[model samples]
Target chain A: MKYFLYGGCSLEAGGKNYMVSLEPVCKALGMEFEEIEDWNCCGASISYAGANELSIMTLNARNIAIAESTGGYDIVAPCSSCYIQLVKTNHELKEDAELRNKINVILKEGNLNFKGSLNVRHLMDVLYNDGGIDKIKSTAVRPLKGLKVAGYVGCQTVRPYGEYDSVERPKVHDLLLKAIGADPVPFPKKMQCCGSGIFLTELDRCLGLVKEILDDAIANGAQLISTVCPMCALNLEMYQDKVNAKFGTNFNMPVVYLTQLMAVAFGMDLKKEAALDYCVIPPEGIIKAAIGG
Target chain B: MAGNYDPSFAKEVFDNVDSGEEIKMCMQCGICAGSCPLRHEMDYPPRQIFTLIRAGRRDEVMNSKAIKLCTSCYRCKVRCPRGIPVIDVMHGLAHYGIKKGIIPRKGTAAFGGEFWKMIYNIGRIDEKTLPLKYNLLEGLVPGIKSTIEMAPMGIQMFLHHRMKLLPERKIKGIKELRKMLDKAKEMGKGGAN
Candidate 1:
């Protein structure tokens, strides 16, 4: 299967490792990625700041128009924020004719038009739905049998427009891990918010939220946390020391992208495919111990 | 902060804020507040904010930190018994607050402004430059102080190659994207600048 890839902004820098790990995982799953040419930011960063609904819709409309002009491929966004922005724009445009007309009017200035004929999917959804559990199991060369992992789906991956899994309690992420032979622990806070960009603004409060999630995962015997969103992975992994300092608790949890764990199971190169070195907290020891690397 | 109620404020919100009319469906259920991760830091939880909007507490609602504290978690929206799209309402309130020149949180406003500006310029964000611009929004002194404060983690990220030192390149269709964005702003009835 082939899909249009929207890397978004984070994937270029903060989430580079996710981009690195995605290639091998997709290759192993028999999926091909075709990037949407000249795609702009999904306008998620400004959604809450000062952007009106029309402004955001117009930005994403241009992208959809670009993809539509190329082919009829579904757009796959690895970043949850991008997924929400694209999905929400597609849904709104399809639902409201007036809104669609307004967005297309804006798009006309760019010599483009939005037809809203594409499906916007999160990367996790593509893996869980398109790449079935059996396919994932078959692709795995080394099954991670005894490793306990907390599947952190974060907020935007499944919420708002959750077609593939439960909004309140998603199991697709966990099930995928189980298929790879990893034990997904009972994490009550799996769907909890990691404060996203709020960690940049409200540091102290964001740390509190991150602390609860890490505490829950660790309490439930999660040796490492597997996450779907780069923002969540950053907040959970990068904020451990901050959470420790504020709450007077030490947390050394290893947060990783879900695809990285899949790479390990597929026996792909740890340095090239998994990009484990990019992690703030080293997960190599636990991962190696589990898979007997 | 009391007795300054203006009945027109709620109407303005209903007509102006995106999905603001959905606030009428709110039934005072505290589910949104209960589900909010930042409730402790908020002056008024979502339900109370909705009540204040209806009560015509314009200044109180506009100045409240509750609206800006939302991180787009979607927990409130998903769990809302009324399906009111609480997250949208909150974000709409935040956007409206900015339009009306009422910034409840300086850091959030600064970060969002810088982010939007970068996207407008190159049609993409440069991670290395975004923080530098955001930090300097408060002037060189505070910017330097904050940058220094974050040096440890910044160094860690740099070492891990999570951030690039080189400047980000503009997209091939940046001019086209800019024209669209400019038209979007020109046609804005109250949209972002």
Candidate 2:
């Protein structure tokens, strides 16, 4: 289970904890990994929306080439946006020879070339598909102890590449919750978009969208929402205050990374320094309760 | 309304916009609008936008804030009965809107410009600096005011150790990155080839 990891800008900045929690969890699961050297931003939704397709494509292609240069180990990108961009580059490069040629020309400037030989998979997919749920369950000595969680599968990672799970009705995360002995709460709006990247542009509209997802999770008795995407977690968790301020709703649900909860469920030793106080609705109470405070 | 409509507009879209040809497949199911997270904020919704495109409301569609407002969430694309690439259409119209100097929404393009500068100049988007630059785009007074309003969150992020007084440095061989990007831009004159 050795794969070279590619942590794009989000993990480099906002999603630092994702790596912190993931490293040990993977180590516990017998997964060996290393970070790719000198990788650039994956150009997220912002780049795709703002720049031309070729530019964003090239941005990811260059990174893929970097991984290829490192003996072409499978690249496991934790962030959904990074995963999408890199996988998309591979998909497009494989499908379109003209695109491959153009991207190769650009890569030649950087003394690299995109061979599209590297396999790109999201960390979530690898955890479920490669790591095996039963193995994870065996280590799940400490369950969530009836913590009700909603599994949110954001758009990019699922659609266009339904690699590990169904795009519309993804149940893998639900299975993950059950494996950890937590109650998997049904969210009708599971596949809905979280209105990411539009926060700065249209705050009112963006918060409205977040409001729907949050209210749904709260209504369905989700003590916390488990998500695979970093942007989804950040947007859902951090914007609760402002969303409540705008919409006048009393929704306060904690959003946890799927990996983080896996660490907790497996009873793997998570250092306190890795515990972030940034979650507006801290899972500490529930986590303590689940682990028996 | 009929007099203001340009008969050539829809044809122009098929000719110009990337994947605009698929807009013709839209059956007016309104699923796109129904699935949209920002549907309430939209004046026409995506279905109606297609209607306007077919009806040759070029100016109306281009000048409308809806084009730039799409978050590229892809809820519409995934759920669309007609398989229209809603996000691409939205971005196409946005790029087209920006190209035509029709920025109906404020701060979005400016924020995008600032973001591009940060990513181009440095390899990463430094959280500490991105907002400052974005706020200052409005003007000194409002920028400071917005920064002040966001101060608590800033402090929280600081406490969370999400920030540093110093910004992120450029990636190694950024000059080559710049060259690749310049070539990308030259190649990016049109959308996806």
Clashes of 1: 0
DockQ of each: 0.73, 0.53
Model 2 misplacement above 4 A: A270-280, B4-16, B21-29, B189-193
* Residue A181, candidate 1: C-alpha displacement in angstroms: 1.1
Q: What is the DockQ of candidate 1?
A: 0.73
For candidate 1, the per-residue lDDT at B21 reads 91
Candidate with the greatest lDDT versus the true structure: 1
Computed on alpha carbons, the lDDT of every model, listed in order, comes to 0.87, 0.78
Restricting to chain A, the TM-score for each candidate equals 0.98, 0.95
Instruction: Considering only chain B, report the TM-score of each candidate against the true chain B.
Output: 0.93, 0.89
Residue-by-residue lDDT tens digits, candidate 2, A150-221: 888877767656778877788888888888888989898776777776676677777877888888888899
Model 1 lDDT tens row, B1-193: 5597699988988988878899999999799999998888889999999999999998899999888888888889889998898988888889888888999898897788778888888888887787778888889999999889888888999999899778888889888888887878767655454
Interface root-mean-square deviation (Å) of every model: 1.6, 2.1
Candidate achieving the largest TM-score: 1
C-alpha positional error of residue B12 in candidate 1 after TM-score superposition, expressed in Å: 1.4
